[model samples]
Target chain A: MTDPDRVNALDERAAQWALRVDAATLNPQDQAELDAWLAADPRHAGAFARAMAANAYFDRAVALGVDRDIPEVATGIPEVSAEAPRVSERRVMSRRLWLGGAAGAMAASLLVALGLDRLAGSTSLTADKGTVRRTALEDGSAVTLNAGTEVSVAMKPLERRISMLAGEANFDVAKDASRPFIVEAGPVRIRVVGTSFLVHLSELGEVAVIVREGRVEVQAKGTAPALLTAGDRMTVPAQGAITREQLSVGEVDRLGLWQRGEMDLTGLTLGDAARQYARYSDRRIVIDDPQVAGLKVAGVFSTSDPKGFAQAAALAHGLRLTERDDAVVLSRK
Target chain B: MSFSRERAVWLGRNVFPHEAALRQWLSARTASAGLEVDDVVQETYAILASIERVDHIRNARTYMFEVAKSVVLQSLRRARIVTIDVQANAQFLEIPEDAPTPERVAADRQELSQVSAAIAALPDRCREVFTMRKIQGLSQRQVAEALGIAESTVEKHMVKALAILTNAIGRGGNVRNASSSVREQRDDSETSDRSRPRERA
Candidate 1:
């Protein structure tokens, strides 16, 4: 998306077409159109040139206005309608033909109206580095604990309880009078009829419960029952059920990204983040030097490839690595 | 299909040495010489392991070369070293007394630079497809499955990239073939290479 084309689309074309162009993420076809427009006429080109020249490059407000409404322009897809189910040239040009004309509109309408939002729902249990997760329960209640995810499943009863085992699983209860949703871990019971809480468990020996939704009483291997609520979180240590302040939103998001096969680090050292990313990956990343280990990296990066990320750090900061038999050592390049 | 566990093992087995060797080869060719084999091997392993569906790579050797090729070219470009002869040295330095004006030549040069930059700026995925087709030589369908994109998308990126390049070249007036004499090296048995319409890179 060149400066001239962006201007031409923004100023000369209807606001609708501009929106579709932006949403396509710089697709080549869209790029071609912009090029053709720039090449075709001096006036069309100038109208774009003048509009861009006169305006400040899209202020945040105007940008937001454009961003928010851009999805709608895609609906002008003169293609087949849901009501008719016909695939003719008028309503159903191939992806190529449609790209030049009504395709953007058609794509936008369907994508905005359904696709983007729908894609978000089907995925379950995304995990991230060093962050926890919590969601509002349906009955004006909530569930909280360790899955750092951005944009998660819309909750329902049986559908709500996630099914998979990754690093850790946490559950906060919302007291429903009808159904009692108990988290199923072999023999360890953290029963919740309707309350607040947290449970953190991974593929390791580490398993703990933090209660933030309501009073979640714990029972396992002669461990005593503990009550927790909205303002509390417990770290199931090698010993006691330690509780802390109400889990913050950021911390919650960090825990959920893991399910998405990522690590959610806002501001953590390379070593700390590496340890979290170590779960999904088989190869181990060793922060050999304490000084280099102390280097803080921050972002919502994936954990699926720990070794890959270490390489990124090496390239970015010249942090070299010494490949050991079982571990990767990070040092000054 | 879920080669997550196997992906790491494959890295350590097939990819590690090959990539380490490429880096060694490149470093051998580079100003930064005498890098530790162990260290470069470690770094190369880490880089390869970073990608998604890396486990889907059946031929670790070819995959390593692909990644190595990208890394090497990028490093070479960054260091302003010519890995290949994209910029032919005008072949000779003979000067015509009535050669074109510097301004006219510069404008043409400026336009060419823009086109080159645009092509260079293409993302890893798009560039890989374009290079294989235009530079290294491959068919659209071959480029498609190799890069794991649709055939149509391969064409789309190709046509778009070509359109941009052609437009840019038209302005520049550098009428030379972009990658003359460059042939796509295919180790067909060594690699599950896609078919390509041959052209010089």
Candidate 2:
């Protein structure tokens, strides 16, 4: 190879090593290989160090909110709600048409009225990372928010509306046909006369609405609305198709298990199950290999125990779970 | 206690002890990479503090370093490293320690605007793919399905977007002060890549 070509190859190898080491703790074999590569030449260490430092540049940007792409409206807060129409025209226009028009007016008034409620004068309730909160509204309805969940509630004599900005929540609505309980999350909204249901706004913008009792109508922009009754579930993928399915007895029992800090995965893919675990904990389960993510997993696991989940997933799928750095990485056995 | 408060307390008891070592370790690598030590430290703290169950951390010292190392590496892989000079653009990376003072908040607003401008400057396809991935939190498969493109193409666009932003931020907004050496090398490498014939995936 030419001198420059050789240098380029070395740099690429060093960058790969930097990525590998950062991905997870290397086993003895891998560690020895990395050590050998670093020891082979003085320039190798320099290249790896430089690459690591370069990586740090991106870290600083994220730390400073430079790479944050989600607009304020997507988060379901008031500051961006007023100006959201102009900015969200391209992406959220369809959902906004439903959320910001007449329905939007109802939501606005509901929030204002709820804001005036005697309890703490706060209309918003948020569950922090690794925490679940159960709150009772003034109107006798109860709502349970999972970890890392946020919802803004508004209530009026005519209607009760709750906007879930992120994460998951379970609602036990007070039967009042005069005041339909509407839960808006991302692109999907669930309107119920008075039913118990779970709304999970996934990180990928998908909305999963699981009904425990009664009936609720699930609506998404540009798609036909779906009517779900007791023991029914529907997942609306972002800007795509809506899938309706039945909730098995096991699934029904597992509904809102997060309230008890338990993760009941009934035939969920490893990746989705890991995401569910991540919702309840700060530690992330990184499927180092994509193939491993597709492995089917089912069990009742602890929400606070991602490591345990990883171990169980690994054991079940004939994979390996390596506890490394901040993330537990799962890989092929 | 609130989760954030409880987290803060847990982090104080477990992760805070290693702050000096982590700071020193990260600071030594920042100059060449064009990062502020404080920013790196803050990012490290944020990662550790966000962990849902601190009790699972068998060794706080090792976990803290692991979090810091992974944060740096993850940031790099997610960020695009172009030939921009970011050292002098200190205002963009300097965040107030923990609490944001009024002045610091104002500065952050300015920095956010600049970052938005940078995002706006991304190539059309790259920006779209990036928005879908980062903002909308769509998977590559989902992005491909939505855009009517191949998943590989989406990944490529994301890599390109990160490259553009990372390089731009690395330069820290001062176009003139940006280091030319890295840019020259990148230009050379890109030229070579383009000149080479396409290979099948």
Candidate 3:
């Protein structure tokens, strides 16, 4: 442990040391040892700071699944380009209204905003793609859509509002809990206060609401609003207002597969989850075997390919697959 | 009370609620946060789980604290990588057609990938703090509270991460202006990291 190997690893090690200090208050002698280590090398001091920054990254990434993004071109350490780091910091904190510990993304996003991300305004509904579009309506405060989704905004500064119209989105509605950030999709109207929530909508009219790290308030157009928590989920039928109930923590993760872009299934009917996973992929999974579709299959597969998804599913669930020209056929062996 | 139960109770009194936060902080602080904490905590618990003798008094809190710290220290000696620890194989194949290609683009890509893997393999705590400040955008105080350490600790972690990152950058030659090339590849690599489904996408 003393060799401390490479400098960056050493810094990372130092941060882990600090995490030890924080995980439980360290006794005096150990504390002194840490102090002595810090005092030994100027490089060590530098590594310690990097270690903190790294921990911050891990914390934020874990909280928000802030997938590690490597920009095509070097953008020189993602930092908010806004003139005032102060404003960006406040905006970043407020936006925590989105990612659970998703704050890391906020910083990257602000860099996008100040660097290239465009902001929005006035519309009660807004959908921003690959951008953190922030808007300050005369009456309501609003942020736009996530990575790939699209949305519209509307507002007269009196009745602030927006709609998910399409794709997954998170909202950090301004503090007028009375005038909530409501998304009117099909027949369901999702309302929320000074809180964070994730909404997934598609052309099929399917709407899903997931809460990662905080509380959320949900209500279909004709129904009353319900308060949900970290693992809570609400699904509205594509056509009907009839909403489903709460799901387990494991269930949210299953559904979250698309977001993570990695999924695996096994020993179950392809008819069950394969059809569900097709949502995230470019190609489609057609269940040719009506009965075999119900047959138990298993493996680990990337959600990106229904055809290839068989690998992961096969590995995990023991389902065999036969891929041929024209289409990938899955039959329970 | 049984030794293990007593230890749990003591941890309950000391850790709990913030236990997740502290662990989260520790995970953030340390590289391999997920694996390291689980391993050490498990070992500590296993040892406690097997013990027939319980330290009667003096607040099992100190014992638990000491053990966890010792675990962290012992953990410091363990090997790093949690994910598929492959060195960066960042080929230019997936780079969008519109991406910039300097004469040395491929060479630059190789260097950057090395730097990134080096960053990922950093120790738990330093990686945690480095991630927080560089990526998560938390202030020193927030990181301090969340990780359960001080602002000074957070600063120390950052300094360490930078030194390592800079040194790694230096190792690949031309460390001084390496980020210039880093700046060029900055905009589009987001989708390139882990889950690139060339298998489909």
Candidate 4:
């Protein structure tokens, strides 16, 4: 056989396999046959790949919006087009179609009459000091704002954007491949199709992202985009090199404890832990000595109880703990 | 390695649109070299499909062109009759940066229309089966039941439709004999049970 003939035969076989694979789940026998065929030759795999790619290419034909009735040519087939129930609409139905559907127009008008359209637009949400706030967006994604956190959410047609204005927020993003969920925190930007993650913008302008599920792509100014999967933590400092660490399951759970009013101070310095406490309570954990403040503290403590935390820290370090009217002060003995 | 469905979709969205330009560039470079453009394209797609991840690829068009160029170079090196001029030309070949310009966007829109036209050009039965399966988003069984034909017959028409469309659209709708080729395949009996269209009671 000629080279062209051989290539065409390979492509033909590849197309057959491609259709079967894409159309439905293949039986074990067919799967084994396909595996053997692909392994038999490099060109076979390549042709199969090309065929699969072509199959995917035509999937976008749905974007053409062709809803015309297909005419029966010669077979005199029954008119099924009129009564054929659409199993599923491949793409996300346009918002216009939803509003134009039965009773949807009435509901939309009622929403507009009630001034609820403003809620659909950009809305600023703030969690007050010592209070965590949880709110569900219209797209079904939920956000849990840490104490003293502020975020402005704008759900556009193409993208769902959240600007982290002040502090930390844990987002359980809904799966929408067409519309990416993007969170902009200071100089860092986090983009994901659908995933749960924590975005924290510290008081010092340091941005930290921790992925709880799926994957997220993070881009910081002047840095290459970093892809973070589950149990990955990345910290972008205000003016320093970015640091990425893979957390253990326990560590990820500890990081997410903020949503439950618990502070994980396992690896935090006394000074840093005190700062964390300040976000949750007005009563401060104050340490006057820099040496004492620099000492590391490790434990899970209630975020609202700074006095108890200071006492425990002082006891552990053999330091003096003085309880003032508004502040619990820890000092080096 | 095999290509995942997600990777295939990524190639379809990012790499497939640039096939016309890739073919044009390949033919221009390989015309004198006597290397088959289709052979190089298939090999390029093979390389693209075998890659583990696509997130690192910032520009897929540039990446695809570079892959095609490498395929051409590999073919030239392997050829028994070595041409010095073709080798040098392949080495100096520069791929234009496919920045998403207004013209590029218009070209992409034109590609979608080409897809519509390709579907329109399919044979009567083949077009109906493809439209129901792809455009109307129906299952093979649903399409068979709707058209009152055997499920296997529906599958056959789909395979033929896919082959014709893949060739037509992948090569910029230049397959003038697409319908004739499909008709030829339709006549060829692959399976005695499945090839003959059985009417559903």
Candidate 5:
């Protein structure tokens, strides 16, 4: 075959491979085949690269609504005729308008329902393991629940109260001076007129409060009420004295990373990181050796991929990885 | 150097838009440098794709132009018959400014129409499959179910669509006639296969 013909054949094969790669995860055999093909010749890699780039390029066609209507010819010249709007454009505009109106009407009705429901009794909000959920209260306050967390909200005409039953949650309390917003976790109570803060109830009955905005009055069982402003993190232990610390804006942002499905494992030991991953996924990252568990890990990792985290940890610490049916075990190599 | 989805997306958004300008620049020099413009483009893409990371590439347009220039230079060197004028032209090649010019802005706006035309130029079955997969965002399995064809057939159509569209857009969008001829030559067996009811249970 001629050089151009060979090149065309190579490109066609490359496109086939590129499509397969883009379509879905390749099996182990197909992956090996692709690896071999890529290593066979340098030009094969070049053609494959071009095909992959083209695959990415054409992905932008979705924005043009090309599926809905195809222009007869591209021509690179703008159409000059100003006739009635194209069918696709008209359809999109009407759909958007109808959606907007429907959403507005639904929200209005939802507010009325929530107001009546809140007046009746408390509402329990629970986020199961491996899920983060956000609930908007009738008072315009919003609460974001971390994985495996539960909070029950009881709002009266005079006061708004939330009971943090387990795990952690961030509260963005709306300003209602007449009705003070109160969050109760164990023996500690946080009262605020309007503020945003995170309340975490640990397994040992320790309540940690981090104020992101405004001011909150935190009162523990045996201590005087303490005032916490923005960037203040106060931890009240089950049977000890309360401790308070100031956090930088960056640190506060890092603390709230779980809301975005991320966990900053920086400065955390392998053992602690494993426990953190448990909140996001059932797949356990088990480290058998105490020495291996004590090894400090640093980096932000996705909360969803516990196995990936285990693998990286194994690689970094030079540990033997054992993938069991329900757990990823890491031991000293 | 390894391939990554993030890098592909970065190239698609940042670098691909400037292909026409790069092609125009290369066309002016390819005559004297003894280089094929398409070969240079493929090589440039290869280089971009193999890079370890794209975070360091602050300006994608300039980086792509420079990469294409180096591809031309590498080819000219391999040929071993580089003219002094061609060498001078390659060395003194002025990359377009980082900011989009008025013409570039207009061309950018016309890009959607260009894409529409490319899709329009595809064979009937090929176009439908491509549209459903790329535009309507359906999985190959879903498309097969919707079209009452085999999943393999959907994949074949996708592969053909990508090959044709890639060549057409790579040459700066005079793709209608070129794509149709190529489609006819390549899709004969697949066309017959598509006609048969090979539905999966």
Candidate 6:
């Protein structure tokens, strides 16, 4: 076995090389030396690859706005009360984190037998902009609600019924073959015995479903049910045949990133991405030109900061951003 | 000999075994040119392998980079896209007979998830500092200012974060057989600290 110190030294060197490569003002001489160091050994090359990959990972995560989720204090330091208002803010944040888990165990006790004895009472959940919530169900399963989404769950002895009133939600159904879990979203109805899947219901009746694990069967009125396994993404337009496509692991991973307040726009039009941002921010993003709306964009962005998104769009596409009191407008420079 | 075998032999014997550095070089250039790095690498490999007199090459590594640069230029010219510098073409002697090949684009997709996971595993303060500097693309001073910490503290956090990440990722894979060789650096002063599970914000 190789010495651990030697490995740490290699990793340290590799990390330095990665940082240098990404440095804003890297000279050619530095590049030449980095290349030389890499060429020196296969091990060096491997370590450097890991380092670079880590860098790219952070690049993507930053774009996705994943970094904004962390609290200011994080874990390394003591929770100091130097700032008066921020101390209160931290308390609220910590309280939110504490309460952030399942709306609570009290949810089960809130069940009244007013409904049919065979049927468990229903619970409705709604998540506003920038608020993602995970709530446990009576049957040991759980549902994670995305921002701007509303879901109502009613479990009967024979069937588990979930109605997506608006927006999107992911369901992790407990295994109960006797009681099939059914999610009704607009024109589509998804049935599963036990599986985790996401259902996105648009106001226009367009529905999209992505299965994380196990199998789910999706159906429309009078149409044959389509079987979607893990990593399957099926999009049903307001009025058209349902389209099914296989999603790469990266693509599927993106689907659940919203739990961390990440907005994954792997392939979205500027208009669509703006709408996604609107779901999180009170300040709306408005594209002044039709051409700007059609511009394709892909990256992760913070949902809570529409101005940041506008600024990024402006910098990236050479567009002009005019921030109004109510909205931020994007147009050609 | 097959082109791949010959090229592999040449790479093993001649070039500085630094695949990571080569890829890094290609990635930076390609990102600016709005081209995929893998495609450029593939093109460069084809040109280098097809050379009739590989034995006559002096600096194999520099020659490969030069050929790679030429491939990008040739591609830009053929496509009628002048995104790169105009003086670039004057620097190359021969443009290989190659067309842009249709290939899958998500070659390094796994790396994103791996890195994200590793970031999630980092200590809270370190993760925050590192994410601000790397992900947010903030300068060290900017990160220090934003967090109300000293610049030196930010740098220390960055170093700690980088060391942790490289150790984790390097051991996991991509630095082949690095698992047996690597160990997580212990910060004796910080080991007493308790880490909270990642909170969903």
TM-score of each: 0.32, 0.35, 0.39, 0.45, 0.43, 0.44
Residue pairs with backbone atoms closer than 3 Å in model 2 (clashes): A110-A154, A111-A154, A282-B52, B80-B162, B80-B163, B82-B167, B84-B171, B85-B171
- Rate residue A92 of model 5 by lDDT: 9
lDDT of 1 by residue, B158-181 (tens): 534333332223222222222110
Best by DockQ: 5
Please tell me the TM-score of chain A for candidate 4.
0.56
lDDT of 1 by residue, A1-333 (tens): 221101111122412222223223447787677657643422233222212211111211122222222121122233211121121121100111101111111211111111111222334545454333333434433333343423233445443443334445544344565655555333345556765344565444345555433466555546676655544555544445444456543344344334223454556888887776664444688987888989876444545445545655564456787777656678987
Q: Compute the lDDT of residue A67 as modeled in candidate 3.
A: 24
- Deviation (Å) of A98 in candidate 1: 30
Docking class of 6: incorrect
Top TM-score: which candidate number? 4
Ten residues in sequence with the least summed lDDT for candidate 5 chain A: A92-101
Off by over 4 Å in 3: A1-4, A9-11, A14-151, A164-169, A172-180, A200-208, A213-217, A221-257, A260-268, A285-292, A295-302, A315-333, B1-201
Q: Tell me the alpha-carbon RMSD of every candidate.
A: 21.0, 25.5, 18.7, 26.5, 22.9, 22.0
Model 4: runs farther than 4 Å from truth?
A1-8, A64-333, B90-92, B97-107, B174-201
Q: Give each prediction's DockQ, rounded to 2 decimals.
A: 0.02, 0.03, 0.05, 0.10, 0.12, 0.05
User: What is residue B24's positional error in candidate 1, in angstroms?
Assistant: 30
Candidate 6 Cα lDDT to native: 0.57
Pairs clashing within candidate 5:
none
Q: Which should have the higher TM-score, number 2 or number 5?
A: 5
State which docking tier applies to candidate 4. incorrect
Between 1 and 6, whose DockQ is larger? 6
| Pairs with backbone N, CA or C atoms under 3 Å apart (clashes), candidate 4 | none
Q: Write the per-residue lDDT of candidate 2 for residues A97-209, one digit (tens) a residue.
A: 11110111111111211112233333888989876666667766778788888999888767888999999998878788888888999978789987778899988999999
For candidate 5, write residues B15-113 as lDDT tens digits. 666666687687677644444455566657765775444664445676677667645643443233455455544244545545642233213546667
TM-score rank, highest first?
Answer: 4, 6, 5, 3, 2, 1
Rate residue A75 of model 3 by lDDT: 25
- Residue B190, candidate 4: C-alpha displacement in angstroms: 26
